[model samples]
Target: MTAHVAESTITVELDGQVRVVRRTTDVPVRNVKANKPREVSDVV
Candidate 1:
């Protein structure tokens, strides 16, 4: 449970002067499971 995005900056003026940019990114979510605990053996 995590979510955050509060950092931005963008200015453009091509063929003349200023051009500043800042785009952010952070993604890390990995729960690689190979049957951690999934037991189902009830055939009745």
Candidate 2:
């Protein structure tokens, strides 16, 4: 069996201060692969 891994990094800045955030998480995968059509709804 084989497994896949993914990672990402994000940075945010506000006013004159800067902040860095790092995180790693496993992505959820679906056993069955299928494409569903999307519908658009009006929003008020």
Candidate 3:
């Protein structure tokens, strides 16, 4: 008796002509705070 293994592949088509492929992982994003308002300078 013999045993065999099967493999599969994936393909993507974009714009009907271009192919886009990517392997991505989860990434963390940081929250940014807005700057405080500055006081105006008075001219003499």
Candidate 4:
């Protein structure tokens, strides 16, 4: 499954003008599950 999350942006003022130093973008997130370990063998 995939999920879209919104990110925040940062603004800064330099010289005498206000500008967006960092921009916001849509980030894709996914759910993950770890695999189960295999059972140990009695005979080695």
Per-candidate clash tally: 0, 0, 0, 0
Off by over 4 Å in 1: 1-13, 26-44
The Cα error of candidate 4 at residue 9, in Å, is: 1.0
Those runs of model 3 whose alpha carbons end farther than 4 Å from true positions after fitting are 1-31
Ranking by TM-score: 2, 4, 3, 1
* Global lDDT scores for all candidate models: 0.50, 0.51, 0.40, 0.50
Candidate 1's clash total is: 0
Q: After superposition, how far is residue 8 of candidate 3 from its true place, in Å?
A: 31
Candidate 3's residue-wise lDDT over 1-44, tens digit each? 22121233224444565343342533432334446899999999
Higher-scoring candidate on TM-score, 1 or 3 = 3
What would the per-residue lDDT of candidate 4 be over residues 3-27, giving only the tens digit for each residue?
Answer: 2233554455557676654445555
RMSD in angstroms between candidate 2 and the native structure over all alpha carbons: 11.4
Please give the lDDT score at residue 15 for candidate 4: 71
Checking candidate 3 for backbone clashes, the offending pairs are none
Model 1: residue 39 alpha-carbon error in angstroms: 51
**Backbone collision tally, model 4:** 0
Using TM-score as the measure, the top candidate is 2
